[model samples]
Target: MFLLEKLFGGKSSAKVNAIKMLPAAYAEMVGDAGHCQLKRLHPALGVFELHFSTANGEKYACQMTACVAGVDIVFAANNRSVLVSPPFSLAKLRPVFDIALADR
Candidate 1:
C-alpha cells in the first residue's frame, strides 16, 4: 500500500488524491470558482502543484501539502484554517502532473 492510501484511505491512487485534495484546498484558498487544475509533483511527500482560474479571469499556481488526522484534515493551501474532518470516502487516484517536470 502507498503512503497516501495509508494516510487518506479508500481506493485512491496518488493522482486521484492530488485531484481531490487540490480542489478542497483551492476552495479554501480562492473560494468557489467552478474550474481548476492541480498538477502533481513527484516525490510527492504529500505535496502538489495547484493551478486555478477564478470566475473573474484570474489565475494562480502554488505548491500545496496535505495533512490527514484521525478524522482531521489540515492542508497547506488553507493555512490550517479550513477544518476538514475525515472519514472521507475516496474514489480514485491518477497521475495528473507531468512526472517529467518533477524534480529528481
Candidate 2:
C-alpha cells in the first residue's frame, strides 16, 4: 500500500479542494445520527480525512482516527467501514490508506 504522494508528486488543486470540503463533510457526518461515529467528547472513528474519487467515480476517504485507545487509521467515507487499524503510527496508516483508496 502506498500514499497518493508516492504516485503523484507535488500538490494539486483536487487535494486543496478536498480539504476545503471537510467542513461540509463533518457537518453532514455529524448531522445524521446513523452516520455519526462520535463517542462522547471524542470522535470514535476519525478526525482528519483525505477525500478521494475512485476510478469508478465513488467518493471515498481515509481518515486518521484519534480515540481513547490511541491513534489509528480508518476508512470512513460515505459512512462505510472498510478498515480500522489497531493503534499504529503514521507510517502504518499509509498502507491502510492504500487499501481504503483501492476498495472501490
Candidate 3:
C-alpha cells in the first residue's frame, strides 16, 4: 500500500476514487429515502447521520459510512436493523455532480 501510494503521489487510488464518488452516492441515497436532511454527526469525523420522517410520521436515522473499501449507505431505524440498502453506480458520479451543481 505504501509503495502504491509512493508511486501514486501519496494517496491510495481507492481513497481517491471513493472521494470522487461521494456526492452522487449521497444524492441517490437521500433521493431514494424521499425527502430528508443530512447532518454530519461528528463534524471532525467522516460520519453523516441522516434524519427523515416516514409516511406514518415516524422518525428514523441512517448513518453514512465510508472507508477505503468503499462507501456504504445503510438506511436503518434508530437502534434497529437495516431497512434498505439501495444499489448505485459509482460511475454515475460525474453526471450527477454536474447536473446537481451546474448552477453553483
Candidate 4:
C-alpha cells in the first residue's frame, strides 16, 4: 500500500519490466480482467490503479496518485468498499514496489 517512487524512483520502464517477469499463476491472476479494472480507475493525470483476485477468491484494488516527491497509494478490499492509505517515503517501500513491478 505504498507508492512506487518510494522504491522505484518513478521509473515506468522498470515497473513494466518487473511485471513482465511474474510467475504464470500470478500473472494470470492479474490478466485482462485486472487490466480492465486498473484502466477503469486510473486518473487522467498522474494516477494508477490495479485489481487482482487472490487464490482464496478475495479481491483487492489499489489506487495511486502522483505527489510532488512521490506517489500516494491506497489499497482497498471488496471493490473499494474498504480502503487503507499508507504513505511511504521515496526509499521506504521496496517490497510493495517489487510486488507492483511483478504485477504490472
Candidate 5:
C-alpha cells in the first residue's frame, strides 16, 4: 500500500484527513460557507480556493501537487504566491491533498 493509504484508511480517507489538516488560518480564509472546497484538476493536481474576504475582492487559491518527492503546496493571492512545504510529523499523517469527501 502507499504510505498515505496505510496511514489513513485509504485514498478517500487520505483526502479527507488531508483537508482536515489544513492550517487553521487557511480554513478561516475559506469563508463561512460555499466558498471552501477542494477541486481535483487531475490525478496528481488539486486546488483549494478560499474567499479573500477583503475589500479588493481578491481570492486565495492554493494549489497542491502530488509528486514523488512529496506534495507541493503553493498559495497564490493577488498575483503573488508562496510555496509551502507540508509540515513534518513523526506520526504517520502525511498530506494526501486531493478532492473527494475532502473538507478543504
Candidate 6:
C-alpha cells in the first residue's frame, strides 16, 4: 500500500487520510473546488510535487521537499520565487502537475 502523509488545501485530517488510501501509483484530484495532482518524487528523499490551480487563471509550479511538520514548498510564479509551508492556499491558480511531474 502507498500512503501520503498530507495534502495542501485539504481542510481536514479525515480528507487527507482518505486521499492517501487511493490505490494508485499517482493520484489525480480535480473538481470544482480545485485541481491537484500528487505523486512521490522519491520516497527516500521524501520529495513530492503538487501542481494545483484554483478557479481563476493564476498559475503556480511548486516543489515540496519533505520536512518535519510537513513538506516545504518552493513556489514559482510570474518569474518570482518564494518558499512556503503546508496549508497554503492557491485557490485561483491552475495547476498543471501532469506536465510539471513529467518534466522533473
TM-score per candidate, in order? 0.48, 0.25, 0.33, 0.31, 0.31, 0.33
Best of the candidates, TM-score: 1
Which tens-of-lDDT digit does each residue in 28-79 have in candidate 2? 4335321212222112222455555433455654554322212222344434
| Cα lDDT tens digits for candidate 5, 1-104 | 33533333445644434444454433444345323344543322333433222334544445544322245344333444434454533122222222211332
Please list the residue runs of candidate 5 whose C-alpha ends up more than 4 Å from where it truly belongs after superposition. Answer: 1-9, 20-25, 28-36, 41-56, 67-104
In model 2, which residue pairs have backbone atoms overlapping below 3 Å? none
Task: Compute the lDDT for candidate 5.
Answer: 0.38
Candidate 4 stretches greater than 4 Å from native = 1-37, 41-44, 67-94, 97-104
Q: What is the C-alpha lDDT profile of model 3 across 1-104, one tens digit per residue?
A: 23323322333443334433454465566565444455663322334555555445666555653322123333222333221122445554323333232332
Model 1, stretches more than 4 Å misplaced?
1-4, 10-34, 41-44, 55-57, 78-81, 87-104
The best-first sequence of candidates by lDDT reads 1, 6, 3, 4, 5, 2
Spell out the clash pairs found in candidate 5.
Answer: none
Pick the winner on TM-score between candidates 2 and 6: 6
36 Cα displacement, candidate 1 (Å) = 1.1
Please report how far candidate 3 places residue 15 from its true position, in Å. 8.1
Q: Mind sharing the TM-score for model 3?
A: 0.33
Q: RMSD of each candidate? A: 9.2, 14.3, 11.1, 10.2, 9.2, 10.1
Tell me how far the alpha carbon of residue 26 in candidate 5 is from the true structure, in angstroms, after superposition.
1.2
State the lDDT at 54 in candidate 6: 65
Please, what are the lDDT tens digits per residue for candidate 6 over residues 1-104?
43333343232443233223321212334546455556564433435556555677554555654323345444343344344444433421123233344443
Q: State residue 99's C-alpha deviation in candidate 3, in Å.
A: 27
Clashes of each: 4, 0, 0, 1, 0, 4
Stronger candidate by lDDT (1 vs 3): 1
TM-score preference between candidates 5 and 6, better one: 6
